[model samples]
Target: MNIDVPRILIAATQSGAGKTTIVSGLLAALRARGLKVCGYKVGPDYIDPGYHRLAGGEPVYNLDTWLTDEQTLLNLFARTSQGADVAVVEGVMGLYDGGAGGVSSSAQIARLLGLPVALVLDAKSMGESAAAVALGFRDYDRRTDLRGVILNRLGSDSHRELVSSALERIGIPVLGALHRDEMLAVRERQMGLLPAEENGDRETVSRMRAAVERGLDLEVLLEAARSAPRLSVPSLPAPARRAARLRVGVARDPAFSFYYPESLSALEERGAELVFFSPLRDSAVPEVDRLVFGGGFPEVFAGELAANLGMKASIRAAAASGVLILAECGGFMYLTKTLRTLEGSVFEMVGLIEAHSAMNARLQTVGYVEAEALKDTVLCPAGTVLQGHEFRFSTVEPEAPERFPWAFQITRKRTGATSLGGCAAPGLLASYLHLNLLGNPACADWFLGIASDASDV
Candidate 1:
């Protein structure tokens, strides 16, 4: 199917340039104009998209070039952004920064999807020099469609004027010049911007809308979003095929909210009936053939998670019974023997895996990894070359022994660092890497097939 998607990507010279705020504000501002807006984040980040959805009143999608291939990436954008008046994609880190060689940079996404770009530059400490910086980004890679610029954190009218005129002379349009306003800043925590679910209250959204309305030029954004080339791709992915139905329990709550819509939809497409339950509050694991635990702020609720002895025992019993269980970062921690909080207090976990976890003040690791299964397991052999992402402020304690059976052999894309992760058994696969099943939907097929075969009762 052929479609025309008027899309624009919001990128920054680097992180902390207020791009997330700008993107969120812009989403709110555009939606406030009575336009149907679809929001997307350019990488594997799961936090910014939450703010985007809260700001725009829609389900935000992730467009990760690392997790999903180019075709799958375009297919996702095309399928998700359908029937929207416009779409805004928030970029990660810097424009040209991604996995080594700028593999999945915001600039790369813009080029891949043939979309225009509007850069957000931090102007707190610079004036005319800001133009030089903008010029470098625009010129660094001419292939990227550098359409306009947003000057964030400008100190004054004079500062905005100084930067705008210099940029105008170089043929770059200044779409907006936003003053440094405290009201625009969102709450943040140890990892990054706090997820909107935790931080985007009504007052916060109102404040963000006001800030963007006051400083952003909505007409310029719309114009740039529509100025992109016609969207063309080989073809849309065929619809998912259904098979034997199986009940799959999914743990979802404030503590376990890291699931992607596509990943879950992939399971449904494979004929698995997804049943939502909560490890945070549910006293017992729901009756299902399989269970999945996505990542979230499980460590923040360590005390409550430990307090719920019944829930922990339920999960442990289920895992021990050989029920297929798949978990990511925070979920992986919850499966361990204990979780040591930042305060050094220890809390008992499910103990399904023979390891303990510790919440660290600093981020232990963050990057894209290619995971190769170390042993035969559901979805391991068929989908061994899985693309995954990891970002957490926690680590496993008394790390898995060198000879301990590993679920996946993970190789960091940037540093080539290799490590063994998780426990892989006949009916279990748990690890820190967050896998997008749509990237390799075969995994979902394999996973659901195992769920069906394992139900011999």
Candidate 2:
């Protein structure tokens, strides 16, 4: 399928280049101009995308090449960006860093979508030297057309002038050089930044709003957007496979809302009805053959979740009865026996799986992962291959040996081996690893396949 979606990607030389602040400000400024702008994050990042959503009233999506195939990624990008004037994609880490060994970087995404790159370079400590960095990034990839440069965190007006002058020699337009502002500092936690949900305090939200307004050059960013070359692709039709299953219950709320829209759409394409229920408020699991619980902040709401006896008991009962359950990080924690907060408080969770999760003051798993199906579960049977990423700060310690074997063996994108949790018990596929459906479209069919087969139960 093809779609003619006009888009631009906000990339960077590397992490800490102020991409978040720049993207956030750009999105806010565009929305303030009353433009219908949709935001897309380049990889499986939960935190940055939260800020993106807050900056604009658009739903955020993760686009990855290694985890999701090219067709699925484009299809999702096309589908989500439909009916919008422009699509703004925010790059992850660096413009070129992807999974292990330089694959699946943001450059890969920009190339795949045929979108221009707006590189944000940190120009605080550099002068004419900034030209070398811009030239290197532009020439290094060759295929990834870097359209413009955004000099971030400038020291002074003279500092901005120096960097902009250097970049001009290389023919890259400087969108704008933003002055370094301490007030633009967003609060941070073990994970990159506290999610927008957790930081909804009136003072904090207002502060963030004001910071973007003051720190960002909105007029300059819009000019950059206007200067972006148009991208044209054939209109691709949505997948037309008939629905294969019906009424699949999805776990949602602030605690479990990390699902990709493509996942639900794929299921719907195969004839599965998607239903959402809040584990935090629902008294019981929705009456459906399949249960899907994606990732979110179960650790932060551990106490309230543990005290939700009705919902906890219902979820446990559903899992124990062999109902197809597909749970990710936060959902993985919800099915466990207990959750230990950073403050040393332990709250009881659903006892469907004999495991306990501990919230640490630091992150436990970060970055992309490759996971192959080891055994039959809700999503796939033995030997089914899958690629995804796991981002979380909660650590799980299994209580009983042989109670639940890991669902898949994890190989990190850049590093060697990474740890993950899974259960072999009938009708359960839960893990800390969150898979973007765009990367693995097969997950939808796998989930529906198992759920449809379980209609008799």
Candidate 3:
């Protein structure tokens, strides 16, 4: 299908160029103007999209080339932003940085979608060199449609003017110039920006809206966005039919809130009703045909989780009672016998698995992985290839072969590293790798089928 959707890609010269800050404010300001603005993230990030959804009051979809094919990305963009006034995509790290060969970079997204790019240059403590940075990015790829520039963290009027003059000489439009202000920044931790569910994010968002209103010219941005040409989106086959009625329970709370919107949506598409429970606060797990526990900062709240012995016991009972379960990363750790924090504090968790995990200062495994299910588990059959990504700073301690039987034979997509990881048993599937059921929406059927039929597992 062909559609003319006004869109602009917000990119950075590098990672810390304040593109997320600008994107958040623009989403709020545009929505304030009564325009139905839609936000999209270009990579495998979940936190930034949370803030974008809070700011724009809409679901922010992710566009990644590696996880999904080009046709899927186009179809997602067309469907999600169908009734919106404009679409804003927040780029990842550097505009050109990605896997081995710039596979899922923001530049690739823009180039494939035929959208214009807005280069955000961090101009603090620099002058014409900012122009050199912009020029390098602009000239690095002649096909990149770098339409405008946004100078961030300008110290003074002279600093703004200096950067502005340098860009004008190079015939690039300056959309906005923002002075360095602490109010424009958001609190962050090791996992990048904190989720919008945290306290005080509303006030921070309000201040960001005010900052953009005062420092930026929204008319210019809207005009550039409207200038994006019509795009020819390729149509693909719709997702297959799913199972009959079924109920699925999900563990959700501050400690276990790292689920992909697509994962849950994929389940819903398969006729599964999701029910959420807090493992840290709830006393009992909800009754459902299947259960899913995604990743989060479980170590930070080890005390609360360990103290909730009632919920832990309930989960243990479910694991033994033949309830289908799919636990990944933090959820995988929570199902272990214990989780030892970096501060040398050990917390007791659900004893569904025989292993214990220890938090490490350095990340143990992170990247896209292809796993072959060693045996028929709750999620897939034996020798079935599964696509997923893993990011963790914790690993199973002692790493004994017999104590922790390997479930999947995993291969890292980025480094070609191979390892025997995760565990699969009767009615159980636990791993550190995060699976994207949304990219291949059909995969949800296999996991959901486990809950439907007793003989499948």
Candidate 4:
């Protein structure tokens, strides 16, 4: 099957080159022109997609080759991009930065999907030397289609002219030039840009769209997107029709908002109705067959979550009644007996797992991990392997580490170091590892299968 979806990748020379701002602005600008736009982010990032959703007014999707295979990633891109005039993908870190051998890099994604690349070059310091940096990125990998460049953080008209002329001389088109504006800066915290849900304002996006409209060449970007070749991929079989026999409550407040749309969709496709409830604001958990706690900043809102004693008791009671529960990262921390904030303030959590989590001054781990299930669990059986990623600052300590039911043998991809992590029991699996169920559909099947059986009881 061949599909023609016009798309462009907005990548950067390195991190902090204003790719998020530019992409967000571009999405809003395109929508302002009455064009339906789809937004995507490369690699595993939950925060940027929040801004993308705000700007695009649609659910943003992720494209990661590490978490899923290339075919699966392409299928997701094609499926989500339907009915949109154009798709704008925000790249992660640098164009070539990824796991070992550039597995999930923006450059790899661009090449794999045949998407045109628009490099966002940080031009804060140098003038003509900016062209040299852009040239290096363009020439570094011939396979990557470097269509044009957007100059960010420019000083003056003269600066733009100098860099534009240099890039033009090198046969690279200058698609845009944004002057340095302090007002356009997005607020940041420990995990990078603060989630847009917490921003709670459209003024930032409005300012970004105005700047992009004043500086960028929208027509040229459209032309580059239209230049993308048709993507030929295998057609996916229609999903089997099945009635939703189980209800799954999902934690989805500002404090627990990290979830993959595809993962949730996978559950829905497998005959599970997802019910979203807030642990911070809701008084009680909804009656459901299973519960899911995704990753988020639970430590930041520990006081609020702890204050919701009713919700905590409801979750604890549900867990004790043999309700299947799955929690990852922030969700995992929320399931512990206690959570200590970075400032030494401690608060009680759901207390389903006999463990305590404490926020550290620095990141504890951040990388791709291959998880091999050590024992039978609700999601998977023993010896099942899944690909996922872990990024967190908090550390979990089991009250009785030696007696804890460790779920998986996690192996870091870069170092190959193995460690026993997570807590698993008959109807619970709580861990720091984040998995995209689209890549591991069997796990989703197993999860829903168990939920259906438990519902029957």
For candidate 3, write residues 206-290 as lDDT tens digits.
7778878877778888778888878888777655555467788999998888776766887887788999999988898999878
> Cα lDDT of all candidates, in order?
0.83, 0.75, 0.83, 0.91
What is the lDDT, from 0 to 100, of the residue 426 in candidate 1?
A: 58
In model 1, the runs with Cα more than 4 Å from the true position are 236-242, 398-403, 450-457
Count of clashing pairs, candidate 2: 12
Write model 1 residue lDDT over 1-457, tens digit each, in one string: 4447788999999999988888888888888889999998888888888888888888888888788888888878878888999999999899999987887899899888887899999989997899999999999999988887899999899889999999999999988878888877878888887777787476777777787788888888888888877776667555455555788999998889898888888788767899999888899999887889899988888889888899888887887786788888998899888999898999988887788899888888998888888766655562367889988899886455765557787899999999877777557778898988888777786677743343221
* lDDT digits (tens) for residues 183-230 of candidate 2: 666777766777777766434434444555665555655554555554
Q: What is the model-wide C-alpha lDDT for candidate 1? A: 0.83
Most lDDT-accurate candidate: 4
* Deviation of model 2 at 243, angstroms: 6.2
TM-scores, one per candidate: 0.95, 0.88, 0.95, 0.97
Off by over 4 Å in 2: 1-3, 201-245, 416-420, 450-457
Query: What order do candidates take by lDDT, descending?
Result: 4, 1, 3, 2
lDDT value for candidate 2? 0.75
Which whole-number lDDT from 0 to 100 does residue 121 have in model 1? 94
Off by over 4 Å in 4: 238-244, 450-457
| lDDT string, candidate 4, 169-276, tens digits | 999999999999999899987778999989869989989999999999999999999999997888676444245578899999889999989989988887888899
